[model samples]
Target: MMKSASTASRSSAVHMAVAFIAMGGWAAFANSAHPMPGPLIAGVVQGTLSALITLFLKRMIEALSARYPGSVGTWLPPLVAVLSSLALLSSVHWLAGTPEIVRTMAVPLSVTAVYATVYNLALRRVAAGGVG
Candidate 1:
């Protein structure tokens, strides 16, 4: 079940921070074999994007759930999130010239997919009159 708004805000902040550090670190490490400064630039670029996405993801899901009901609600949000993540991550990484683009994007994409799936399921259950 979800908590109070205050609690949710704190949790979201923590999650965003962790995502920024972890995903950025992973990107940097993944691209470490490249020339100097490349890894650093990639890390900053990816970290910023990851944090922004993390911040918005919950709200996106909630809005999507409310906007589209029933069967469509169950799947559309996750599918949208995954596709959007793919496009954003890939495009940004490409623009940033991030080395090993696929590798840099892998973990974040997987995480987004998993989070979207699990969150959508939870929303579905709650909508179906089950415990949230």
Candidate 2:
């Protein structure tokens, strides 16, 4: 059974929300372990921003998939989304003066990469008629 666009979008939004909370909680806990000020707030901020970024990236992937249909289209979008999101978030973190810049960026980037990969694979499988 195929899902309508609205249904798929809703499902993606839910997944993004869950990813945001999980990643945010982990980041907050990790930051608290370190001697940083306002760890909880920082974590929340990072997580929220990261989740938004992921959402945008997913949208980009969808657009690209539509523009270029084939294996190239299927695989390239996810890779581009991951790399672009990482760069954008890292830049944002640096400009925002986030403490432990590398570590902070790492948490979200790792989350995005994992999520994007799984998301892309699932999308491809679905596009291929659910044949894994």
Candidate 3:
């Protein structure tokens, strides 16, 4: 069954919240060893970044998958996601002075990569007239 627009909006909101809270909390905990207020600042930065990424991620994957076809379509979106995640997370965390940047980004990046891969695959399946 098709989802209503409100349902889709709610789902997006929930995803964004989870990304913001879980990834941000993880970043904060990972950076807790740093100086005062640093962890808090990192949490905010990571949370905002995670939320924005989650918000756009689905559309980005859909566009990328459509722009390519066949095997390239299957793999390219996820690869781009991983690269984008690394670039964005590392650069933003560095600018934010997030101590242990790699640690803070690891889980979020991994999750993004996995989600991108699975989502892309599902899109392909649905496009090919198979059950996603």
Candidate 4:
């Protein structure tokens, strides 16, 4: 049984929403000192980043679905993990007034994009060999 286009889209949407909410919740809980807006923005940022990463995975999944249907669910969460980890690692800007907390939230985001682009272009050269 193959998933229709709409089903795949809805499934992806749900996954994206869950990823966004989870990251926002975690950021909010971990850093209560910062304002809610930053965490909300961070969540949005994470969702956006993860969505981009998903595009890459879609290709691999399409090719593999015929061979290993069960692995789809198991293999997909790591992309979410990558997104959450990237979001947590990249927060550099302070909330509007909070100066004591210094982190490069945006830097990680920019770096993630650069790395993502590089990944898309040169995945065969680096990611193919496994963790560096």
Candidate 5:
């Protein structure tokens, strides 16, 4: 159980890292093509913030599960994380002068949604003594 939990956490972190890098790279490329300011820096900032958010979300989920220990604990944290992360990312991009804030967030938000869903399912399976 413990090992699976550790593995899941590590897996989630790695997934988030890769997603962040990919999304950042794409953002940078898009910004450059549009002749926008600070493409590289913007990408780096987005990626770093994404990774940090993922770390926080993972810890929050674990802590919630530890305290509540049921479906409520399992699902709520990821739900909250996804919503909050989206809001934060959108806010960051908007503040950075990224045009079409909603459009800018589309890919990253999709990636995060997928991650949250998978991570939650994996945790639930592991908790139920199934293969992670």
Candidate 6:
């Protein structure tokens, strides 16, 4: 069975995802009176959600590290964090924007890559307690 801490970690991820979805939905609805979502509204939703991916990952890492301790807790937590955040940031495509697509993608991708690398490096040195 998974430890209480791991369960909590999973729960936290779920909570983050739910919160983002809700936020996006509300923002989209508020932006447009009609049932259909607008391009700008959709962009806002994607941006907001993508922005929080790293935040959620960071929270999850802290929670897991504190509870699990050591390497398993350390590297593993960060590994999960980096991977999930990368996955999230990858899916944030704009509805209609060809002119600035390359430029827009570059900044976020570069930032996320750097963040993941640092997170991974730190996690690797975290002690490796007992949990595997």
Model 6 poorest ten-residue lDDT run: 95-104
Instruction: Tell me the tens digit of each residue's lDDT in model 3 across 54-128.
Output: 998889999999889899999999999889888999999999899889889989998998999999999999999
lDDT of 1 by residue, 11-125 (tens): 8778788889999999999899999798998898888889999998878998898889878998999999999999999999999888889988998899999999899889888
- Report, for every candidate in turn, its global Cα lDDT versus the true structure: 0.89, 0.71, 0.90, 0.46, 0.71, 0.52
Q: Mind sharing the TM-score for model 6?
A: 0.39
* Candidate 4 lDDT (Cα, 0 to 1): 0.46
**Residue pair clashes in candidate 2:** none
Per-residue alpha-carbon lDDT of candidate 4 for residues 49-124, written as tens digits (9 for 90 to 100): 4555444444553343334334443444334434654544444223333222224234334444454444443433
TM, every model: 0.89, 0.70, 0.90, 0.35, 0.70, 0.39
**Model 5 / residue 49 / CA error / Å:** 1.5
Winner by lDDT: 3
Candidate 2 per-residue lDDT, tens place, 80-112, comes to 877797777667766666666667667677766
The candidate maximizing TM-score is 3
Query: How does residue 32 of candidate 5 score in lDDT?
Result: 66
Instruction: Tell me the deviation in Å of residue 2 in model 2.
Output: 20
Candidate 6, residue 122: Cα displacement in angstroms equals 0.7
For model 3, what is the alpha-carbon lDDT of residue 123? 96
Runs off by more than 4 Å, candidate 4: 1-10, 55-132
Which is the winner by lDDT between candidate 2 and candidate 3?
3
Instruction: Give me the runs in candidate 1 sitting further than 4 Å from their true place.
Output: 1-9
Candidate 4 or 5, higher TM-score? 5
Q: What does candidate 6's lDDT look like per residue over 45-65, in tens digits? A: 545765476455565665666
Worst 10 residues of 3 by lDDT: 1-10
Model 3, residue 57: C-alpha shift (Å): 0.9
> Could you give candidate 5's per-residue lDDT for residues 1-119 as a string of tens digits?
99987887678668678767977776676566555566775677677777777667667666655566677866776687778888898778877876445655677677667776677
